[model samples]
Target chain A: MIEKQINQKAWFMVLPVFLLVAFSAIIPLMTVVNYSVQDTFGNNQFFWVGMDWFRELIHSERFHDAFLRQIMFSGIILSIEIPLGIVIALAMPKEGWGVPVCLISMALPLLIPWNVVGTIWQIFGRVDIGLLGHSLAALGIDYNYTQEPIAAWLTIIAMDVWHWTSLVVLLSYAGLCSIPDAYYQAAKIDGASRLSVFRYIQLPKMQRVLLIAVLLRFMDSFMIYTEPFVITGGGPGNSTTFMSIDLVKMAIGQFDLGPAAAMSLIYFLVILLLCWIFYTIMSNVGEESSNGGV
Target chain B: MTFNWMAWTTPTATFFIVIFCMLVGMTIWEIKCPGGAPRQSILHFETTRGDRLFVSLLGSAYIHIIWLALFASLSLWWAFAIACVYALCVFRWV
Candidate 1:
């Protein structure tokens, strides 16, 4: 066997990336970590409280409520978006003049800015002037997102689904497009049913992209802030205050720096742990499925 | 440039410095020994040196946070001990 080469020069090439990450990410992260442990008066004076902020955060009931709401919202989002996206993708035209039309119409929702989506939904759900709320009122429904907690929850969930389901659809469509003609030919020869084709041919082929879509959707939904903030402002009695919104309220609105910083770190860690679990479970399932439990 | 804007405190500075050292040390080890191939372990997935390190660091952070939450005091040594055990298990079996 030939001896493997080790080039020390590679470190020099990596230096620029290291510096970029250090300045962009590490420095800000370290600043937050620094603030998490220390309390402050005015004039940039800080006293080392040594985990006091962290202690307060973990034990706080507000934190628990936000966390549970976040988890529930993410669960609902994943459940709805994944299946709905797959179905939409399946029904999407694969060839002819309809393909671009379908693709562009589907992509239209995703191209809108997040804040604009929130604003649109906010207006569109107004009982007095907005289309959805006005229509619901005309139907004799007692739907008011501003005052009713259930209505507020439903509206935000609907808004998120409308805003983001396109992403899942696009990814799944791409996955579907990448499936070669031979797979369908093989399935046809075997006299496979539609569901069988989807199960053995489509889904297995789409697993990689679907995994990506699931992870992206899970993380984005878990960290949801802007749309809900713009629409509900965490109002109607804090029913929709996810962790990021709560963290912003603490850090910016209340100016509780230490607790806010601590909360941020904890919040990030929870997401990390959850994403890791999702990644592990999904990967294991995919591996087992593909390898026939080997 | 002064780091005064960072609101630097001694303990937090030391904490960051230690983490920096760990990263550098891991890189050096990878360069010298070069045993960084992905391997399957008890965790039922393939992991490399970097993956184990990431899990270890993340686990240690949660350990410390949990200790603070439960005891209402920073049990540095105990948390460290737990983190070491956790890291060892990850390194060996994950």
Candidate 2:
């Protein structure tokens, strides 16, 4: 075995990335923290309010409902996208002219801006001018996402699936590609059924990537804002108001800076906590896999 | 209902023309200097060619201002052409 030297030079290589992340992420986070503890009465006037906003947010029924809605949305999105992505990945041809075309087509939706995606769906779901709306109306279906709560939920969910399922497919495909052919050959020689092969070989191989996919989808879906906000505007009696939407409403609409800041902190913490849990479980599984190999 | 046939046609035509010219130019360059040409320098910090194109075309203030100007002048075809060029640039160069 060759001994590897620890290279300090790579730290310099990573410096630019660190600086960019700090500018984009850390500074804004610090500003949010600053705003959370201060009471503001417009025109930059602020007074220290120390934990008042936090207490109020915790007690607010609106916050509670928003939180529950957020959880449900995230849960539903994960359950749908992950399995769908996996199946799509599995169904995709491994090698041929079709691969690149399929990959590019799948990736196209993800490349569109979040706001544009919302606009596309909004138009697509419109009963008057939109294709989907016109077809549904022609077929005698009472489908108006703008008015109905269930319609709003279904449209948002479908839009999210269309937008994000490709990520899971791509990640799972990468994981599948990395698995050595020897494993498959051995399984085939053993006369393993397709389901058994998937169960025993494909799934274990995909565990790490699936963990990553789960965590990414969880964080992203949990903090989803632009698409749903543009489409639903958190309307239909606030049935679709996720936490981020609620935060924006408080901060910008109501100008309740303190409460919004507090809620933002809570939101950040929840994501962090969930991410940590995911990381722990994933790492432990990785360790177990490596140890089992030994 | 708001579908404009003329709005789509001009830009689509312009886009294909630009792409055709670029590809033809690159092919000519390759034929004339089979052995070598100066390598294009790229900014190391940028993510991808596509991302850079997106920044230049849609994210840039100038491009947006130009687009708005064209739209205001009712040069909708011109606006569409610019949009097509924007898409083509992103697809080809990033």
Candidate 3:
């Protein structure tokens, strides 16, 4: 075996990333961990609560409901956005000036602040000055998102889809663009139909990007707060109260720091677990496909 | 209940119309030129036009989000200003 040289200087190059992550993620995470195990009252007085907060959170029905809502919201959006994005990506022009124009348009929604998106929808869904609400009302549908749970759910889902599907589209489009012209030429020579070509070639080529898109969408949706908070304020009655919103209501709104911190830890763990599972499964699928081809 | 097409606000209508124009422009552009060649920019990575657009948009979004979070009470115009500068840097380097 050949001897490989290890460079200590490379450590300096990576130190910035490590420092940034520690400051932004690790330190705050540790603070939450510290808070999770201790009960605190005014003036920063604290008592060791041990596992009490976690135990209570795990048993709480409100926590469970919010968790379920978070899960359900992520599920609904991923199912819709992934396929919808793929279809839109397929329809998009693959080259030239069209490439930049299409990409920029798709990315426009993603560039807007989350709260602004919620505010836009909030006004857009108002029965008085809103376009959608007024149109729905004029069509003889008694649509009121504020008062109706189903309507609220629908509106939030629509808003999320509108906000995020572009990410999927952009990812898929990038994946599509990476496919060589030779692949299409080969498909033509094989007399493969459009659908078969897409299924065999395009979908397989897109798997890695699709995996990234899915994981990103999952984590973001799971941690969703600002947009829905602006729109519904977690109610007409707590109908749109997802996990993050609930956690905020507990920690900041109610000053229940211990329980909120515990809940946040659990929430973080769930996202990590799900993302790991997704990564493993998708990567294994990728490996299997390459092996089968060989 | 009667439907009134004119009830749509100018901002909302303008939003959709701009999106429509973009789609139309893209279609016309594709008809004119069929493919993009990847080019090396100031950024080390080779990028196509689409990639550059994506990087700019994503970077701008992060800048805006961070700005909003840091200065919640302040006017957002500064964020827009910074985003414009960020976009320019991305287009130039990335």
Candidate 4:
């Protein structure tokens, strides 16, 4: 029998994390919670409203519309990105000079700042000068993101795919790279089909990374603000107004601190809840796979 | 120390204090009874006490919001009552 040794001094190493979380997350969260129940009319004066903002926000059509749009955007991006990333990862070369080329190219999009990516896409989707818009127009498509709701959505989706799919790609590629050659050699010897290889060998290995990729993509897309803000400013008649963008508009544009704070709380709650659901469901799937092994 | 940066109202302050107390209590409870022996609940997923607590808290938030949305003129004490029942059901079954 082995007696496990515990270190008392090891607790010191964890103090910094708690301190950081307290300052960064807990303090600001407490502030937001304070603001959510209070109304202000400037000069640092505030009055208690007692859940009035949360009540109002729950019934607000604008909030509902923005939330639905956010959900739709997240769903669309996840559906596209996850599969596309896996496919790209599968296609990537295992050896030779192409490996670095593929890895670097896949990484380049992620390296760009979010706002800069937005600006680049905003220009890239212009009807007059930009390549994508011009090419679409030249090909006889009615393509004006500024004018058309559908066009704006299409542009945003394309921009998001171009910018963030690389993250999924890189994660999946790493997952793929982790597989031992012995597994592949055995599969080949066993006369396994490519589809069988993917279904059995590749996918199971990629599960954890894909879970991470899915959660990251879901959260990022759900809280999408900068790109759409830069590109459309939540325009084309509130077509691209995600929850975060709308929250910003409420907080800064209208100076409705209470409602904005309430909205922020709700928005954060929704993200937290959805992420938890994703984690639970995915882990359940993992557990089932492990238990059954079929 | 001084805490003047935020304009804290009683209800809001109580709200945070309650959350903080619940967290501390949960930590103590976890230390006292390790693992909590994850169980497959009515939701058809395995969850420990912490997971159930999170689900309950999140559910209570939605319940309160919905109650406020629907019954604006009514006293909020009833909503709180309903949330308590919801939490009980979660802890008992889920």
The best candidate in terms of DockQ: 1
> TM-scores of the models, in the given order?
0.95, 0.72, 0.74, 0.95
DockQ for each numbered candidate: 0.77, 0.01, 0.01, 0.74
Instruction: Please give, for residues B1-94, the per-residue lDDT of candidate 4 as tens digits.
Output: 7676687878878888898899999989988887875898998988899988888899998888788889988988888899999999999999
- For residues A100-139, what per-residue lDDT tens digits would candidate 1 score against the true structure? 9998988999999889999999999999999999999999
The reply for model 2, stretches above 4 Å from the true place, is A1-14, B1-94
Worst 10 residues of 2 chain A by lDDT: A285-294
Instruction: List, residue by residue over A35-137, the lDDT tens digit for candidate 3.
Output: 7777788676667765567667766799989999999999999999999999999999976788789889999999999999999999999999999999999
| Comparing 1 and 4 on TM-score, the stronger one | 4
Candidate 2 Cα RMSD after full superposition onto the native fold (Å): 20.3
Residue pairs with colliding backbones in model 2 are: B49-B94, B50-B94, B53-B94
True interface contacts reproduced, per candidate = 0.85, 0.00, 0.00, 0.70
Models ranked on DockQ: 1, 4, 3, 2
Clashing pairs in 1: none
lDDT, model 2, position A142? 98
lDDT tens per residue, model 1, B66-90:
7877776545789889999999999
- Regions of candidate 4 where Cα sits further than 4 Å from its true position: none
TM-score between model 1 and native: 0.95
Rate residue A281 of model 3 by lDDT: 73
Q: Model 4 fnat?
A: 0.70
